[model samples]
Each structure stands twice: as C-alpha cells, then as structure tokens.
Target: MLLKFSRNGRTTKALSCLLSEGFKRNARPQQAANLLRPSYLLFSPDISFLRRPSLLVKRVVCWLSVNYQISSNSWSDPMDTNEASSCLVEQLAVDPERQSSSPACPNDGDEKESVFKGLGILDRFLAVWIFLAMAIGIILANFVPNAGPALQEGTFVRVSVPIAVGLLLMMYPVLCKVQYETLHRLLRTRRLWIQIAFSILLNWIISPFFMLALAWAFLPDEPELRQGLILVGIARCIAMVLIWTGLADGDGDYCAILVAVNSLLQMVLFAPLGVFFIQVISGDSVSFEYAMAAKSVAVFLGIPLGAAILTRFTVRGLASERWYDQVFLKWIGPWSLIGLLFTILVLFASQGRQVVHQIVSVVRVAAPLIVYFIIIFFATLFICYRLGFGYKLATTQSFTAASNNFELAIAAAIATFGANSDQALAATVGPLIEVPALLGLVYAVKLVAKRLGWKD
Candidate 1:
C-alpha cells in the first residue's frame, strides 16, 4: 500500500516509500525509525522527533533521498527483501564526498572543521609569510640601501604611499566581510553595550596603565622607548585588530563595531591619554599632535571603511546575495593577506636598518610589549569567556583589547618627535613585535577554544 506523509504542506515521497517498504517486510516500527534517527538529529529543527521518534521518522528521512532521485526499479517487488533494505540504506546514507562538494547543504563535520580550513595557503601560514616579508624588507634595506629611501619618498597625508596602499588593500576586504545588515539588531541588543563597556574599561582604563607599568619596569633608563610604549598603549587598535579577529574566527560584525567605537574614542582621547601616560605619569616631556592621531584614524580607517561600504552595498545591490557572498567575497578575500604581507615588507623595509642595528633597543622594547600582549589577551579572553560571550565575541574582545594602533602611534611619534628620533624607532618596533605576538595569540585562542568546548 502506498502511503503519503507531509511536513509543512509538502509531501515526502522517499519517506513514504521507506515506511511502506518496512511495513511490507513486517519490520518493527522501532527498527524502521532507528535508521533515520541520526539524520533527524543532525538536520531536523523539530523537537517532536524526540518524543515521537517513530511517528516523525518518515518526515525526517525525506531530506536524505531528496537530493538524489530514487528510481522506481529500486523499489520494485522483483527485488528480494535483503536487496530492498540494502537499496534503501544506500540511498539514505549521507555521502561525505557529496556533502563536502555541495556548499548548499553543510553537515556536522563541516561545522567541526578548523575555522582556518577555508583560508588559502597564504592565510594559513600567515606568520611564516610575515617573517619572510620582514626578512626580505630587511635585506633590501641593508643591501640595496636606496630602496628604503625610494619606497619612503612619497607620502599621502604623512603616511608612506606604499604603506598606505597596503593598509587600504588589507583593510578593505576585511571590512567588506562585516555583516552590515545585522548591525542595527546588534546595536539594539544590551549585550553589545555591555561588551562595549567592557572594551572601554580594558582598552582605555586597564591596558594603558598596564603597558605604562611594563614599560617602566622593563625600560627604566630608556625614556624614549618608554614614551613610545606608552603612546602605543594609549592609541588603541583600529586597523589590524580586524585582521587578527578574522584570523581567529571571531565575529567580524562585532569586531567592526568595536573598531568603529575605538576609532571614534581614539580621536577624542588618544592625545590626552598619550600626554597623561607619557608626560604626567612617566615624567617625560613630549608633544603629541591631536591632529596627527585624528588624521591617522581618518586615513587608515575612514578610507577603507568607506570603500568597503560602497563595494559591499554596490555589489550586493547589483547582484544577488548568494552571488555577492559566494563569488565577489571569494575573489576579494585573498587580497587581505596579500596586503598584509605587502604592508609588512614596506613597513620593515623603512625601518630595517634600525631593527637590525638597534637589536638591543628592539629587545628592550619587545620584552615589555610581549609581556603586555600576552597578559592582556588572555585576561580579556578569560573574562569574556566567563561572562558567556562565546568563542567568537570573546576572541574579538581579546584581540581588540590586546592590540594597539601601531600606525597611529608611529605617525604621532614621528610627527611629534621627528622621523629619526628614538621615539619613532620605538613606535616602529611596535608592529615588529606585534605582528608575531598576535599571530601566536590567534593559534592559542583556537587551541583554548577547542579545549574549553567552545563551539562555533
């Protein structure tokens, strides 16, 4: 007897056939239902299956055979009982190969895979690429000698043209990936405000003071380096934090919101905070250009953000959301890594000689920074995790809290203290140390999440 079962007004042919064939074979209802339990648990949204396992089995089994059309011959009476059961099992089995190939229907294994699995080779070995880029930049600076000067000659708004281009390229793709549509809902949520408040406390209140203490503890005699470290601490991250958050598989929408908030706060507070930490607190006389910090935020953040908004809305408007997500995003995604590497090359090349020659100074500066980054990242991560923020938001909060606005710090240092000053050198060392340090944190965060059972 042919039976018909419908879910949400749609008939399920495969499920009907399975149940009819099972009953014809005189199979127990429980046994027939058992075959579909795994599929049901994996895919079905309905909890009714939990209470009425046998009753809902037919509806739940439909998805298994929906993708592949089962021929009538397979279900013909000419087939033996064993043959029929085998045929049903074969048709209903979830094929791993097909599941991986088809992006439309993702399985549990896909969800469990490493977040970094989707990234390209360049993104996977990001630390290695960054080191190689830094090495090449150093070699160019030392051997070619003129290459650094040539690359550094042109400046747009006091940022090297090469560096500016790399920053824009790196940041644009990342910003484009932000879920702008969800921002309104995110803004409306009280959790977002709580997170923002936590960020402000950690980044503005705790982190700067912590770095100042580290700077003093590590570099007591080196006043210039201490001043630079304090500046780094107070500036707060607006740029590379997004890249780090993305690499760590953090929530890009939340990271973007934090970044925007930090940028605005940095404009208002960076100069005063710098003065407070360096001069008032550390007893170092230094002039910090408020305009320099504002301009750095505008150029580094504003330009790429505006471009990303235009690109995202324009492409999404012209094409379907699926096309934009699956096609345009895939095409532009790799450029973020490319830009990161390029920026590293240009940045290190500009200051390569100093990095090489002033190894002692670099070490002195790096010691405190390394300590500060590790402590702040783990502390913030732990706090957020305890607060039940989940892996994505916790990782985002940690990176944003731990990272500094190196571009702004370096620009302010140079504009205030001159290009060749020790303060500028210290500011430059911030990224040199930060790149590898934060890259390490990315891996650490993933491992910790796995250990803590933090599901994505």
Candidate 2:
C-alpha cells in the first residue's frame, strides 16, 4: 500500500519525498494567525531560555546587572583556566594557520568549545560556495530545462516547496545558538538602551532610506529590481547577524538584544515600511496584503524561533545548559551551514535561467549592494565612535545594521509577488553579494581591533 498525505488540498505520496524534492502550501494570514495563536508570543527571542533560573540564579542575575557595563572592558574579563582551555581546544578544531596562532591555556580533557567555535570552514568560504552554487544552478537550468520548472509546481503562498524547506533548515540552528536567557540581564544596562536606540536609528531610519536611494539611483528602468532592494532594507537581519556579530568578536549579549528587538519589530513594521517605501520610490501604486507578509514572517521566522526555544528548554532540562550550548548545539549548529548551502543551491537552481539571461542586470543590481555594505559599515562605525562605544559593541552595531535578512526578504517577495518575479530575483541576489563582502569586513574588523588593542 502507498502511503500519502494531504496538505493545502493536495495529496503527496510521502512527506519525506516532498521534503527532499519540495512542497508548497498556500498558508494565508488568518490561517497563520490561527496556527500561531497559542505560541505567537514565542516568536519573540526574549521568551525562552535554555534553563530556568533557580534561587541561586536570582543572585547571579542581580550580581551581573550591578557589575555589568556595556563597555568591552566590563565584560571582557581575563579567561579562567577552564575557559582558556576550552578556547584552546576550540582553536585546535580549525585550520592549522589558526591553530598556530592559538593562545596558551590549560588542557582540560572536558573543555567546552568557545561560543564562536561555530564559525568553521563552511562559513569562512561561504562566498566561494555561493558563487559555485550559482554556476551549477545556471548549468542545470540550461541542460535540464525542466529542473527549474519542476520545482515551481504545487506552489503555496508563492514560495516554492524546495525554497520553503531550505529556509527552515537554514534558520532553526541559528536560533538554537542564541542565548536568550542572557537577554534579561542585558535589558538592565543603560548601555543596552543606547545600543538599542542606535540600532533602531540605523536599521529603521537610515538603512531603509539608504537602500531606497541606491536602488532608485541605480535601477531607474527596473522597478522590480528597485522594489526588491527596498523590501530587503525594510527587513533587518534576525538570524545570521548572529554569525557575523560573533565572528567579528562582538558582544554576543548585546547582539542578542538587537536581534530580539528586530525580530519583534519585523512583525509589526516590515509590511508597512515595505509598502510605504516601494510606493514612494516607484511612484506607482503598489498593492500588498499585510496578511501575506505576516504569513511569511510567521512561517519562516516564527516557526524556527519557536522550535529553537523548545529545543533549548528540552535539551537543557535533560542535560545542563553547558552541554546544550557547547556539545549538542555545537553539533547541531553546522546544520545551519548545511541548510544554507543547500538553500543556496535550490535558490539559484530555481532562478538560474533568469539570472543567466539577466547577467548584466544582476551585476548592476549587485553594484549598489556592494556600495550599500561599505557605506553602512563605516557610517555605523562613525556613529558608534561618536557615541563613545568601544570596539566590540561598535562592530556589532556596524554588522547588525549592515546585514539584511535576505531570507525574510526573499520569502516576502515570493509571497507578495511570485517566485519567478523580478522581486524574488533581486532578493536572491542579496546573499550572493553579501557572503564574500561581509566575510571581508569580518577580517577588517579583526585587524582594526588588533591595531587598536581592543581585546575581545
């Protein structure tokens, strides 16, 4: 007997087959609201912690708040023997070049990995992989011809089935890595408010306008491309900013606050801001259902966030928070990278024909994006410097503002427009430009830190 299941009024032979190939569902906003009603609040990154605080925890929380300042010096204490040992073990897991430069520390057999140990070969060479994926996708689209068309069938909410699955894979692990429990202690600091205000100014006020200007200035003839860029600007980075912020040796605690705030804000502001900006710039009436945008956020951002929170709670309950973070999460975190690469492959393959046909246009779209990253980085850096923030916080702010949530943008584009629309094409181009460009910025930050003697 053949096993089959029904979803969105369609029957499939097997869930796993659809999962591997691709599946689509036309989830509407009301449906999303109903589906997420019980756990909608869980979408906020502030809602869950790996472990609940005990009587002993209250004291620790109080002590931390009383002593903690937003400055790097306040948080960057001298590593204890165990921490240093863990750092050394983490160093040994990477390249020989990185290993030779590793700092000295005690060797404890059970030493845990550094929080930043999650950045491995895959992350470092992400741009190269993305470029190769794009090429392979284009090749497949040319030879197979049906490859792209095949994935487009049975679409729901305008998102391709393969793209939907790939997105879920890319996001869940990133959320799992966040230490949401630390966010409460972080909220107590005046420095956090300063960072929050500064982040808001950049993400909402500055970044959106900046992207709008660039897209309009560069793509006068291509309204779809312009709209796509504007859509990207409105949705701030929620997930992968953690990776960039972590790799740059920024304050993880502060970054968590920024991520949480942006996640909440995206739900409220993304659709309005997107519609407002796109209409103003295009001078063309744009029709976008807020519900569709909300649905996309609910499925892509909300679902992964909920899963991560529950997973953290369960794992920490079974073992300790330390094991969850260091051992289990360390193993689980790479799935994000795997998911990212797979998503890239599927994303490019689906759009390969269009990208090849519009190669020059793609390059033109990328030009403004490259400029946007550079300008935002330095602009944010200058503002952070003027605000008297230290290097770690400054860099975190810079990165958070500079990176866009391309996944969210892509999902919204497909949901609002269609998978094959120019908007989706523009959204897909974002990660392509960002991966290598942002990686370069990471090294620049490290070198600057070394020269300034601002230790992480």
What is the C-alpha local distance difference test score of each model?
0.78, 0.68
lDDT of 2 at 226: 86
Off by over 4 Å in 2: 1-119, 154-157
lDDT score of residue 210 within candidate 2? 92
Tens digits of per-residue lDDT, candidate 2, 231-251, equal 888879876777777667787
Per-model TM values vs. the true structure: 0.78, 0.71
Pairs that collide, model 1: none
lDDT of 1: 0.78
The reply for model 1, stretches above 4 Å from the true place, is 1-115
Q: In terms of TM-score, how similar is model 2 to the real structure?
A: 0.71
